[model samples]
Target: MQGRNAGIFRIWKGVTVSQLIDAFERRFYYLRLSITDVCNFRCTYCLPDGYRPQGTRNTGFLTLDEIRRVTRAFAELGTEKVRLTGGEPSLRRDFTEIIAAVRANPAIRTVAVTTNGYRLARGVAAWRDAGLTALNVSVDSLDARQFQAITGQDKFHQVMAGIDAAFEAGFDKVKVNTVLLRDVSDIHLDTFLAWIKPRPLQLRFIELMETGEGNALFRERHVSGELIRQRLEQRGWRCQPRGRTDGPALVFHHEDYRGEIGLIMPYAKDFCASCNRLRVSSMGKLHLCLFGDGGIPLRDLLESDGALEALKTRIAGGLNHKKQTHFLHQGNTGITRNLSYIGG
Candidate 1:
């Protein structure tokens, strides 16, 4: 499938809908929409203290209708790809409906969901029927005990079962996301890769980012992508450049593996220079930067008789103000929002 089209990136600098699509050819018009702030697993890096209020906890989640409206507006502005995320998107009551709504838009070519894979087995087929294009499962560790410890849940088997079911359900591409921690989950990297070798899947290792609730964990345990590649080489895994795609993960193909491995080294190496993503929280806030302090509240505008044209103008303006990069380094003290709220 062709990636997100270029029309999505034409930013209207001013607050006018007429300039939504300028002459610029920005091909990566990908939006990561958070469906909810609640999740089933309380992962160490994501939700530690049981989903406590971070920067703004009282904010309400967008209703299904509201989400559809915003999504439709974005689609009109050339947003060809939309990925539904959440504390866990499956936790949403009408997730299938949401997927269907996104698919109803003719301009949208790809609709993906990134989940913990807890409820995927039961819902993967239904989601596929609803027009989901791909599934990205977050599996940090292959060890059940470590999985429970990392996520604060005992649903490791269920998650694994869900992964298998996704494949059985005919989901064309399945990508496994693994967030690498220095001494915590890094040791199981090779083992996890070995297990997924037979499957037609892409294994991704993400460097831990210092964000809300998990900032402390980031300071304690940090791992770089280079070290991960070296460790894989030590395990007799040979890698080669595997080109680029949507999202900030640098990919590599292993010599004898059935699939590829991706390393997202946001800390050690910053891809924000070419970053082409925008995040809309569950509450309809448009965030230009992942580590940005606040987002423009578009929910109220959309609810208060906001025109689709006006909404497009607002999104364009927000994109123009997008930060070049975020500062999330070791020992750098900065108050940021939680990954759960921003749709990890």
Candidate 2:
């Protein structure tokens, strides 16, 4: 109903709304929920100038009750993992409350949050106590100066301290997300590889993709994740099998190191074949694909607990319209203005 896929809509109506399976047979079991689109760091690849409000779209973030309703519906549809993402998810005042809401669902096993780690040192312990099961921090570079240059923040040491705090808070391992930028993260591969040698961390290098506002930067510094994969394989890292609710990253493990490596190569062949995650923006719109159009609004249906059935139906119906793959390879970034806009 959201896109120009009337034929699929007809089929969706006839099919049983049991689980989240698209026309291509990809079953979605993971949901990325964006609590807010207000980031603090100005990463060179995303939010270079920091977050800017779009038009009069302020004051539209989903309320706590709405979030609870959304999670309940998804849990009924067999969602096992719920990852809290955002421009900065911690920006929300009720972040801990939101975590408890999602963790309340018995069917939902994983309650993860991907943050910038600015508050992890001071708040990770409390967040852990509030039922947060996993943590992912974005650290583009290990060198303090290089990190500042890429993220436009001088709190590299502070962020690093936050990672230590995460371990102290009882996290088995903290996943680190680093956008692969040419001449930036590429040259410091050894530094990242070495830093993780004895640490309980999973360093994920994500390939930079073109977005509505990052075309020029994408052209200038888009590094191939495939190249990094080759380097890792050559150095004796073995690819590990992914779990049912695991993300797109191809995880690799090395016997010589305590940490693991993950590569998120979006441009790779058959990248979308194993798609199992869906996204919901802070404003309560369901995005079947990260690079999809403006998404299907579900805020109205989320207002009451009575609308749970309708919410599930609408979400299952949207799967029929999900494309087999994103058009990023064809240079089509769709309506995504930036990664922060929809919680990339």
Candidate 3:
């Protein structure tokens, strides 16, 4: 009985006997899974044409069971954290069920969801109950008209309500992610900061990257994180460097705010050297780098009743061959999917 209890405890702590063999040597154990390619709102950075791709005879959306199997396999490979991303994760009918399954797995420690916050108002509490630890909502502008203009959807009020609902749902942390463009959302920086000052939520300002379909926009309107910081400093906001986390967001604390701010400088300031994440698209392709084009498709392998140990070997091999840095520096053109397809 004691031995069995110890075994259960070990699994609960993500320290299984099989995990001890390889020692989970991967530098980063974070996994970003795209649950779907469907979204309700067509944000400028996401879907510029306000068009969602439809399924064809050759393409099919991944089922919830398939997602669970892939997630479980990754967990066994020592992925402690899993984030569900999408065209909008909430659009999936079984999103809550998937979250619950991932959370029920003892190997996964953190379960996060990134959304546009459209459905958060009614679904936030249910998602929490289903085992979501944190929520990251994309809100680029505070102005209603500007927000509608950027998202191509006049649902700013719905987004704001979703954010409030997330807070009300007792989420430990809620992050508001904004992609900073040169002259677009940059002007509303102060308004965003002021709004988040009293709340415990964190606001993340992301630099436009060249990986998405909006390559032209990225090249034409790229805004550096340093410039944003400078603008904040001019507003009497002092920033102190915070420690590193899994992703690219560089955190800072403000003097006047109870919350914090994060700068994700993917283009202007690259952190690819310490990059420690692998992205798995909804199609089951394993992407090593955010800027790279190569990915190992695991869907076929899993569907074939392939050996789990062999799958681990493939994952390890993929990580071992991961580029130390992305091709953003050399103008390398190997990338295939955009940020939306890969779930930013």
TM-score for each model: 0.87, 0.94, 0.86
Candidate 2 CA-lDDT value: 0.90
What are the per-residue Cα lDDT tens digits for candidate 2 across 1-344? 34433112222565423357778767788999999999999988889888898669755799999999999998878888999999999988899999999999988999999999888899899899989999999999888998899888899999999999999999999999999999988888899999999998999999999999999999999989988989999999999999878999999999999999999999999999999899999999999899997699899899788898888888888887889899999899998889999899
> What are the runs in model 1 whose C-alpha is more than 4 Å off?
1-27, 53-59, 232-245, 304-306, 330-335
Looking at candidate 1, the ten consecutive residues that score lowest on lDDT are 15-24
After superposition on all CA atoms, what RMSD does each candidate show versus the true structure? 5.4, 4.1, 5.8
Q: Model 2: runs farther than 4 Å from truth?
A: 1-18
- Worst-scoring 10-residue span by lDDT in model 2: 2-11
TM-score of 2: 0.94
Model 1, residue pairs in steric clash: none
Q: Which stretches of model 3 miss by more than 4 angstroms?
A: 1-26, 52-59, 232-245, 268-270, 304-306
Across 225-341, the per-residue lDDT of candidate 1 in tens digits comes to 888878776867655553222777766666677777877887665466656567898878887767776788888667743577678777766655554567676444233556787
